[model samples]
Target: MSWRFVSLPPQDGYHMVTSFVSVADYVSRGGRNTLLVFSVKEPFVNVGVHQEVWLEVDLDYTSKAGIPVVRRDLGGGTVVITRGEHDYFVVVNQDEAPSDPKALYAKYLSPVVEVLRDYGLNAQLKDQDIVVNGKKISGNGAMTHGKAVVLAGNILMKLDVDLMSKCIRVPTEKFRDKMAKDMSEWLTSLERELGYVPPREELDKKLKASFERNLGIKFEDSSLTSEEIEEWERLAREKMEEEWIYYKDRRHPELRTERCVKISSSVAICHVDYKARKLLRITAKFLGGKLAEVSISGDFFVMSPKGFIELLEERLTNLSPEDIPKEIDRVFEEKKPTIFGFTADDLKKAFLEIVNKPEVREVI
Candidate 1:
């Protein structure tokens, strides 16, 4: 299908973010698939949908620096968007995009990989990251927006590593130094590798052509619909309020303890401790509200298949909140993996304590 293509001039934080959201809402209401490309002209800190402002960022630093901190309606880690990064949002109908995570990332990120490779960088998609060699060059994030799947990512042309590290809250200046060093090694930009950043006009043209050739679709240059503009205005107004910037902190003041951090409506990182006959600690990474990565530790004994803990962790993957205790009990009954000290009730309570909380506001 022919997609509507709108390449915006470098915009401020407000328009850059809300444009994709408005377009995604447009698609949800039966508008055409869109490929919106733009860059941020002003420096700003974009907090992930689920990131805690106090835990993750240095508000005093950002506020003093005149860099507005805004929470985007998408999953991923906090990102520092400034003058040099170019971003693209693929807002497509759910039916048009692949539902499988791997398939979706490969399909959407391949164009960027191709563009990077053409620019003499060995760019490839390593899981969710667009990497050059082993270092990440682009950080991509995705989530469903109504009837659309919104995949957003950016190419770092000239990253200010020092500024980024300083914007994040750390316990000490010593730790911040360590973080800056690590960030420099972990992330790369065109300027760092190529001795110069590519011209914006050149990169933009190349990206448009690369996307078309890679995705087997043609783009017809278009503008946002009146409905999308109206929605953008409303979203902009809402996003500008302090509540939206610190939404997570405002809603769940208790999670100030950093027990759970939601990346999106369906994805979260959670932790909880349950006391039974022993101190049971559970750290879980949830995907689609199901336990994706589960780590159980602290004073527990397991009767073994040699790898009973591993097997149990694997089994917990993709199990919903209601199924956790039932599965634990089933495992004990059928597999006899006999985890001593903590009963399924302890496990259930721990799971409920973390998952059933006021975290990400339910999208539905």
Candidate 2:
């Protein structure tokens, strides 16, 4: 059956989120499956439904800047969203959607990757986020909305590096600065890739076209049903309550550390910092039993090509346990990057020095 297509009118922070959740509920109650797309009318701090806003958001900064902190019905890290991001949601009957989160992301987001690649960017589905040239272009998450399942994601059009970093609570200003730099390197947008933001009207047309081609489903033009609207209105008010924003993300004070900690029960996030003549900060994510994302940032100087560190970081990924040293050697030999205060061997040691445990407990 063709999906009921609703292009939500871009509005303030709350309704932008409630629209999809309401649609998902409608689907749960035997309404038609939906493909929904919309953007926010203003920038807002979007907290995951499960996140503790106190830990995830800089509430003071947000209040000062007039950016509303919105809690969405999804699972992901906190992010700052502006109209520059285009959001897409697949709201369907639970019976029709994949039960596994990975399956859900792969099925819906892979097609968006194709759409991105068509615009001359080398895009791929790497785990949950979509990336282009090792930089993430999208954030995605899925959750059951009542009896229906809704998979949601955003096409990051232009990331506000400074604001994004500032809005998140970090251990220190240094961490926030590192975060801004890391985001500038690792996260990307259509504006950065294409040299100009594409027209929204054109983007809107192409977005649906890709879904039709990729999923083999027609989208009937539609609007929110009266029932969905009422639900949206109710949710819009409820989500604004303080209780909803900080629903369930409090940890023990002892559990709080300067370094990264747990995202959920299963995931452990670790940030390794080692100080020598020069500082090195490593943000690592592993996939397929290999290094997936390795962002090395600090006051280190490299004398190869202009993009030597970026090249090194890229090559360091997807390496096996033993291949790391070999990979480091290959990069040093091939690129011949000279450091003012560090040697290639030092670089290799620094990487190995921190990654010496089963759980990534500490770094020297």
Candidate 3:
């Protein structure tokens, strides 16, 4: 059946979040139909559901700048969304969507890649992020809500690097400066790449056309049903509270000690940082050309028991550098562990980088 579609009118950040959630519920209840929603809300700082706003965002700056901080139901690092950027949300029945999150991302987000390519950008999905010239151009995440799959992300018309950097509550000014510089280089936008923001109206037309052709589904204009409106109100009241935004993430704290140390030629310790739908930080030590010990820690959501992650790490220890990926793949396949917004491959690549370190550095 054709999916119902809605382009939500621009509203405050809280309304936008609830509207998307409300629409996703349409599929959760045996509706059997999907929903494609496009929304752009007022400028706000949004943090992952698990993240503490005070830890990652500068509350003072956000308050003074009139940018409200919100906690999204999805899991990911903090992000800034402004008025003009495009935010796409796809709500599909789990039975109709790919069972695997990785495949689900590639399937639904392919049209987005097509749109970017049509504009002459070399876009591809790499490490789950949409990248061009090895820099990220779009960010995405996927999660299951009841019987529905919710995929959400943004297409950058332009990015405010200074504001993005200043809004984050990093440890020091030096770190903030570095964060701003890195964002400017590693993150990009359509305006930066094409020299001007494309007409959003035309872009919306292209998106609808591309999705129809790629997903083999028609989109008919639709309105929010009375039931969804009620759900939206309830969710807004529950999800938009200050306590939710400031809730502490129980994941491992930032490693304060040295993360890298060189033991000798071909034997060293290294740390690798990776991101997909969630942050992944890994610490690995190599000895005798094999993994001696490794630890995986981050704010990523793990549905397994508390010790499951440790067991996965233990299963990988002492494996050859080349064999780590295969083992990680096997564990994920057999356990069917759920880490929201990430795949086994995303975790493997992070571990491999440390094992494949090309240069030795002093303790960090």
In the order shown, the candidates' Cα RMSDs to the true structure are 11.8, 13.7, 7.1
Each candidate: how many clashes? 1, 0, 0
Q: List the residue pairs that clash in candidate 2.
A: none
Off by over 4 Å in 3: 249-336, 340-364
lDDT-based ranking, best first? 1, 3, 2
Cα misplacement distance, residue 201 of candidate 1 (Å): 1.5
Q: Model 1 Cα displacement at 270 (Å)?
A: 11
List the candidate numbers ranked by TM-score, top first.
Answer: 1, 3, 2
Q: Candidate 1, residues 1-364: lDDT per residue as tens digits? A: 6989888878878777788889989999998889888888889888766455776689899988998888777655677898878888999998888876668889988988999999999888986679998899998777776788888889999989999998988889999999999999999999988999998778878888898998889989999888888989899888888888876566444334337677687767766767876556667776765666676543443422235555666777788777888888786676764343466678778777867755522311
Worst 10 residues of 3 by lDDT: 249-258
For model 3, what is the alpha-carbon lDDT of residue 107? Answer: 92
User: Higher-TM-score candidate among 1 and 2?
Assistant: 1
Off by over 4 Å in 2: 249-364
What is the overall TM-score of model 3 with all chains considered together? 0.73
lDDT of each: 0.77, 0.73, 0.74
Cand. 2 TM to true fold: 0.69
lDDT, candidate 1, equals 0.77
Which lDDT tens digits does candidate 2 get at residues 183-242? 899999999999988877777788788888888888899999898899899999998887
**Pick by lDDT: which candidate is best?**
1
Checking candidate 1 for backbone clashes, the offending pairs are 50-262
